[model samples]
Target chain A: MLSPAYLAVAAALLLALGPALPAFAGRPIIAGKPAPSEAAATARWLTAQNTWGFLSTISSDLSGAPFGNVVSYSDGVPGESHGIPYFYLTTLDPTARDALEDQRTSFTLSEFPLGTCGKIDPENPTCAKLTLTGKLKLVDLQSSEADLAKSALFTKHPEMKDWPKNHHFQILKLEIENIFLIDWFGGPKPISPTEYLEYGKNQALLKLS
Target chain B: MLSPAYLAVAAALLLALGPALPAFAGRPIIAGKPAPSEAAATARWLTAQNTWGFLSTISSDLSGAPFGNVVSYSDGVPGESHGIPYFYLTTLDPTARDALEDQRTSFTLSEFPLGTCGKIDPENPTCAKLTLTGKLKLVDLQSSEADLAKSALFTKHPEMKDWPKNHHFQILKLEIENIFLIDWFGGPKPISPTEYLEYGKNQALLKLS
Candidate 1:
């Protein structure tokens, strides 16, 4: 084993090499992830950790084809996740336009980008993926829930605050009805929407304390 | 200006650091991405570089809700791309099953994960995102095109070959109808599927020479 003096020198070297480290080294403050075995917790962790995912809606433009668009979202502010993803979208984009015409949608996230699945193929079941299917509903700007959503979104995606005001960006959220989580080799984990949303309420409280 | 000797020393230092360098520094051989100004080229680049994306289909299980699932795909082997995304999907997954019932689908990809969009919020228009909407069609196993797809899929996603044979994985290709690409601040760049598929044909031929 190395002596204390040697360890101290190595630590100093690492500190001096700041900004040269890999980007993944400085992960954003994630609202803790759950063990793979905890289906509800795992599903919630995906919602909290991922900053962007594909949001799908039945497209009126494409004669009712399912259109998936890359979108940024937040479940809550860091370490205080509520397991419901909120998006800032504009009808100028097809996804929002489609949602207005057809509320049915799904938001899909993968753990591959989280940098935890080293050397594993992203398609591999062990890497984990989540699909939350539900209605994509607009949040009324005047509602208290919209206030919470705005705070959650702005904190995670600071750039959203400065998007062109004329674009009429509105807050939209998925009223999750079904949760499909694949965290292991077997089939999808059975996670009801309610179980997923409530999985870490106490833990989040503990973290805040 | 630094002396030649000084520059050589700096280069040596970087080489010695090896794994300490940022992971993006070691990007896989990408079919060179076109300038952001080349809308069709940029859209094709997104498809050629990304290994996985969100495939959205009309979900039969969820009462025709648009379902987005994370899936692995390939447009071609490294340095050679045809701009058609091929997926090895199993009906055991909802996405494939959904596609069988309703072929209308869209595959979405983002450049943020490719590590090219440094410090850009994923939702930012400059970061680049693509959505290919089309019919997801199965390639018959007996067709010569299936052989080409298999080669492309195996080269990029080797683990696919090892997946359980009993899982009934089949090759599926998106017959792209529309292309939505956002690479700059303006808006989605309008690109026809034909323009996207043919954008780099001449460049690809020149490279082969």
Candidate 2:
């Protein structure tokens, strides 16, 4: 009983919504497919834009075990309010990554133009990404600790109290000695150190400012 | 001593490289300090583009526990292939993902932008993407017990190989009703029927030919 126009409208509507978007409700439409290079660049830009990264590490047991955790972090010393970075993390006695878990650990942080779950952009709702690879080292929050990570943290992220104290609060000073940013779709080139720093700064500003 | 020209070149180099990336090597730059959305997207794109995607499923034991496995996929029709979507997996073998041994599983696939690995382009890497998620299913290979799945897989990846006989090849098919796609920074969004077709098509042809 419906006209062809109706079907066309429906199809057009579907096309406009983009892939896997919520507009279709439960149905997901596959949105922008980045050509390898484009996708990779998009990923680099994402890593540059977003300041927070995930921490994937091998457990203490040395069983080749991988443990992934959502963590909050910063770029500068947690002192002298200037150039400080931090986040509100809710945890309870997370010693391994808690208030006092500064040990040698490897972490990977990445993201791409294609959006994904866990950290969907509330504003854009349709992009997907993930961290390529990086490393994370827990910064000692205690002033006496060797790492200068304490005061700078509380100043920027004042909302720390709002987070449940069940988990010890602390900061992870990022030590990205080497990261292989993969954008197989983009240009399939590794992110240069200079490029990475430039991108990281912008991302930090987004987080702090 | 550092010369003025050296400093100027350093500044120029920094500017050329952008500030996000650092100049010093073996230095860990803080990234994803707050787990921004972009980084998440990069990570997601990597998952989708690297390995072919597969659907994962779980079986319950007598007491109702869950067990699962991630089956490699090669997508496309069996004989005349357009893309490889199925995986070299094991079938009818509960031992691979039986509840007694396993409880959780992950589904992975690569999204090629244009060149290298799963990149779709040769010049840009920011756009590279990979989709990673858990939960998948199995599909009939459309072949005899002695079958090859090279033709079908993650949107027609050129790097994948055909089905392996003795290696226990099982196709990772998704429950169309429960299918979802997430970007690196973008969290899980359901894939609609419309997106399914478009992405399926894109998987076959890099561009809309």
lDDT (10s digit) by residue, model 1, range A1-209: 44445534654564466545321121221234555556776777677778999899888888988888889999888878888899999888889999888888899999999887666678777678999999899999999999999999999888677676777899999999988899765589898887887776666433321
lDDT tens digits, residue span A33-115, model 2: 33233333344444433434344443332222223333334433332222222333323312143222323333333332224
Question: Model 2, range B71-164, lDDT digits (tens) per residue?
Answer: 3343343223322233444433332343124323333332332233221121011222232332244445675522544444423433223222
Worst ten in a row by lDDT for model 2 chain A: A117-126
| Residue A58 miss distance in model 2 (angstroms) | 0.5
Best by DockQ: 1
- In candidate 1 the C-alpha lDDT for residue B12 amounts to 57
Error of 2 at B161 (Å): 15
Taking the tens digit of each residue's C-alpha lDDT, what string does model 1 give over B1-209? 44445534654564466655421121222234455567886787788888999999988888888888888898888878888999999898888999988899999999989988766678877678999999999999999999999999999988677676777899999999998898765588889888988887777622321
iRMSD for every model: 9.7, 15.3
CAPRI quality of model 1:
acceptable
lDDT over C-alpha atoms for residue A17 of model 1? 66
* Model 2 ranges with Cα > 4 A deviation: A1-44, A51-53, A73-135, A142-159, A184-188, A192-195, A198-209, B1-209
